[model samples]
Target: MLTIGVLQMTSGVDPEANLAVIEDAAKRCAKRGALMLFTPEMSLLLDRDRARARAWIESDAPDRVIESLSVIAAKQHLDIVVGSIPVAAGGGKWANRTHYFHPDLGPPVTYDKTHMFDVDLASGESWRESNAYEPGREVVTVEDTPLGRLGLTICYDLRFPALFGALGDRRCDAIAVPAAFTRPTGAAHWHVMLRARAIEAQAFVIAAAQVGRHEDGRETYGHSLVVDPWGEVLLDMGGDAPGLGFCDIDLGRIREVRAQVPALANRREIAKS
Candidate 1:
């Protein structure tokens, strides 16, 4: 069994303040004997104001936030999945990117969020993420982690199954789905969808989520979760506040589930009409 820590955060516009929270969590995670820690989407900054956010987003080069996280990972001797951060992707656009930092690895493995959240909701909240963010093109997975082969996905990508199917095809032992879901949509579909994804992929799903109201004037549904291959929810951090939660993942369960169901092995593609 591998123990991992998930940080449910109420991040703000200030990257420094957000980093402090993460640093504290890393210390606690290390003390608790967790080998890896996972954080929520927009872990550094959650500003909706493009003008104000532009100053913090960096292109190509390692930004201050990334550098800080790298140091934290090395210092704590803990692998960290910084759920997602905003980085300049050229053409006046940014990428919602995930950075996986390992203590021994010099540079982090990165994955940009594939699907963009472009919607006009009935709650009168409209988000056109494509306007300011570029979409990622490739499916990304990290090999030989504490959870075995781990796949990466961000907030909006959870709504799409093809991505998860590709991850399942790759035979990922675990998938990280860090998110910052809106209150309305999160309340309606969060638990069910996450549970379904875990069962479908036959892989452990670790989702560290944003929670409560933020300094940027938006609210998010928390409920950071860890689900097993059998669709059992191992941990649910609840929707009330932000904190660090830990879950013990039994890697052997992956083999057991696959042997019983053989979903990934039995999967056959249906021809398009």
Candidate 2:
């Protein structure tokens, strides 16, 4: 069993403030023997003003948070999976990208968010993600990691099972879902969906989430979770404040679950009646 860390945070408009939170969490989790750490989406900054956010990104301007994380990863000898950072995409748009840094591997692997969240919720919560960011076309799965084979997905991507199916097909042992979910949707679908993904894909699901209200008047549901292959909720950090939580990722348990069910090996296309 490998120890993994999850950072539950409520990020705001300031990158520096967010970095402070991340740095603190990183040191604490690393000290606690977490081999790898998964942080929440928008770990850098969450600004309602897209214009201001875009202005923060530039070719010369550094992503200080990621830079600091890389250094922290090396110093602590830990693999770090940063949630998502907004970077320059040019053409008057930015990209929501996740960065994974290894203790030895100097450069990080990046994955742009594939599905954009452009929905108008019934609870008066609305997002126009397409207006500010460009969606990614390729699916991503990383095989080389301390926590076995891992898959990456952001907030809205959690609702789409085909992506998780793709990851499972690639034999991913676990999936990381970093989200800043709205309170309503998080309340309704968060727990159910996380468990479903684990059960359907037969992969461990670790979700690091944003909690409470933010500077932009956005309130995220806090309940960062870790679910095993048997659809068990291993850990759910259910607090209104920022903190660190950890879970064990047992590859043998994944093997045991798959051996018992043999679900993936029994794949077949259903015929339409």
Candidate 3:
């Protein structure tokens, strides 16, 4: 069994402050025998203003945040997956990018978010992510752990079933869904959707999330979770304070579940009308 840790945090605008908390959580997780650690989207900073975000966000790959995270991962000898960072993608657009790092790897493999949350919520929480960011084109999967293949995705991507299907088709043993889901939607659909994905894909789901109110006064749902292929929630951080949750997993269960259900082979192309 492999131990995975999910870090739930409430981050503000200061990268330094955020890193301090994250590093502390990493140490705690490492102490608990976690070989892999995952953090939420906007792990470094959470700001409502796009222009202000561009000021601290970087265009190059090796920014202060990424560099610091790389050093942390190397020092801890932990496989780290940090949720979306606002990457300067030119023309005043930032890419919501995810980073996967290994202890001995030179640099992390970046995964830009393909799905943007462009809807207006019932609570009047409106997000025009496309207004400030560019969408990614490819799905990224890497294998560095005993857990086999791992796929990466960001917040809004959770709503789309096809993305998970693509990941499952690639024989991904687990999917990392790092999110900063707003309060209303998260209260309603978060648990259901996450569990559905876990059951359908027959893969372990690790979702580290941003919770509580931000400096921008935006309230987030803070139930960071880890679910198994059988749709069992292993750990759930209930509030805004930074915390880590562990889940012991046997990857062989993935094969056993998939074979018993045989869902992946059940897909069929539909005839066009």
Candidate 4:
């Protein structure tokens, strides 16, 4: 069994303040005996003000948040997945990137979010993520972690089954889907989709989410969750507030579920008509 920590946050516009929260969470997670900690998307900064955010977005220099997290990971002897942060992707566009920091690993492994959240909700919230961010093309997975093989994904990437299918094909034991979901869509789809993904992939799904009202005039659905390969919810930190939660993941459950269903083995390629 692997004990993991999930940090649900109401991140604001200040990177310094957000970093402070993460630092404290790392210490708490270490004290709680968690081998790894997962945080929400935009854990560093969640500002709609592009002009103000650009100063912190990494271009020519390394991101300060990532650097700090690396040091913290080593100091705490904990692995941390900083859900997603903005980094310059060249061509004047930034990428929503996930960074995995291991205590022994010299540099973190990274994954850029593949799907963009560009939609007009019934609640009058419209996001044009592609306007400022570039989408990633590669599916990323990490090996030899406390949880065994783990897949990396961010918020909008949850909606794309093909991405999860790829992770399933890779036989990842657990998948990290850190998110900053809007209240309306999250209320309607969050739990159901996470459960479905766990069922389909036959892998544990760990989603640390952003919650509550933010300093940037936005509200997110909290409910940070951990679902087992059997589609059972191991933990759910409800929508009320930002906090840290822990779940014990049984690696043996993956084998047991796969033995019953064998869905991944049954998969076949479809030919275009």
Candidate 5:
């Protein structure tokens, strides 16, 4: 069984403050014998003001948030996944990227968020992420860990099915979904969407999330989750509080479930009319 820790947080615009909390949590996870720690989206900062965000976010040097965790991972000999960081993507834009770090690895594995949360809600919450960030054109997945192959994806990507399907096809044992979900949408769709993904892919789904209100006055619905291949929620960390959640997984379950169902192999392309 692979032991994993999911860290739920409510971050602000200050990178230092966020790092303080995350670094401590990483140590705890390491001490508890967790093989890896997964964090939520925008693990560094979540600033609402575009000007302030651009002024504070950087691309010229390594992000302090990721750097600190990288050092911790090496020091403690742990593995970590920072859900997403808003790094300067040139031309006054940013890329919401995920970083997977290992104690022995030189550089953290990266996955820029592919789907942007561009929507207008009926409850007066409107976001235009494209205004400040550029979308990633490629999909990324890694397959060399104790937990078997795993696919990495950020918040908005959860709503899209095709991405998860493609990962399922690749025989991933688990999928990482880290998010900073808005309160309204999360309350309505969070649990269902997460369970659906696990059921559809027949893979373990691990999601760490941001919760509560931030310095920007925006609120997020937080319920960090871990689902088994049978789509049963093994863990659900409650809303808005910072803490660590654990799940002990057997990777062999993925193969057993797939063997009985065999959905991926049964899939066929549709014929054009």
Candidate 6:
């Protein structure tokens, strides 16, 4: 069994201020004896301006954000899972990438978000993430302290079930869905979708979310949660300040649940049946 921390926050356009809050939360979680930590998506900046967002992307090998996080994780001797960072991947395209850094690892490994949230809301809040960002081509899974084989995913990908199936097939013991979900959609389907992923995959689902309003006046539903293989919520924090939660993860439980259900091996292809 291993202890994990989930940090939920209300991030905005200021990177410095957000970093300060994240540092404090990480310190607190480390103090509480957490071996692994996960932060919410957009944990660095939350501006709608495409120009400013583009400027924040780092071109250097050791991006300032990753460098700083590496130092912190090494100092604390903790495995840190950074939510989402704006990354440039050639052709003037930016990818919303999530990173996983272990204490001994030289550099953090990353997974870009595959799904872009492009929705036309009835309330006039339209988003075209694809216009500013490129979708990722691969699904990534990595091993870290406390969690054996962990799958990484960002906010919008939670809506797609095939992603979870892919992770399960890769033998992911836990899945992290770091998000900055908008108020409307989160209120409508967040809980159900998160729980379903945990139930179907039989893997621990750790979701750290962004809450409150942003500089763009866009409200995010912040309810960071952890669900067990049985689809039972272990921890739930509803729109509170940045904080962490702890849960003991049993690596053996993943194998046990999969063996009991045996659904993964039973998957079949339908051919116009």
Best by lDDT: 1
Per-residue lDDT of model 2, residues 1-273, tens digit only: 779889999899988888878778778877888898889988888888876776677644446667787898888788888889888877877889998988874888888899999999999878999998989777787777876788998989999988998888888888889999999999999999999999888989989999999998899998999999999999999957878888877789899999999999987767889
Model 4 bad stretches (over 4 Å): 58-62
Error of 6 at 84 (Å): 0.6
Compute the lDDT for candidate 4: 0.92
Instruction: List residue ranges in candidate 5 displaced over 4 A.
Output: 59-62
Go through the candidates in order and give the C-alpha RMSD of each one to the true structure: 1.2, 1.6, 1.6, 1.1, 1.4, 1.9
User: What does candidate 4's lDDT look like per residue over 1-273, in tens digits?
Assistant: 779999999999988888899999999999999999999998988998888888778543336667888999999999999998899999999999999999974889999999899999999998999999999999999999999899999998999999999999999999999999999999999999999999999999999999999988989999999999989999999999999998998899999999999999999999989
**Minimal lDDT window, size 10, model 2:** 57-66
- Model 6 residue 110 CA deviation in Å: 0.3
| lDDT for each candidate structure | 0.94, 0.86, 0.85, 0.92, 0.87, 0.84
| Pairs in steric clash, model 1 | none
Distance from true position, residue 271, model 3, in Å? Answer: 3.5
Model 6: per-residue Cα lDDT at residue 254: 71
Off by over 4 Å in 3: 58-62
Model 4 compared with the native: what TM-score?
Answer: 0.98
Model 2 regions more than 4 Å off: 270-273
Colliding pairs, model 3: none
TM-scores across all candidates? 0.98, 0.95, 0.95, 0.98, 0.96, 0.94
lDDT string, candidate 6, 222-268, tens digits = 88989887788888888745566667777777788878888777777
Worst 10 residues of 1 by lDDT: 55-64
Clashing pairs in 6: none
The TM-score that candidate 5 achieves is: 0.96
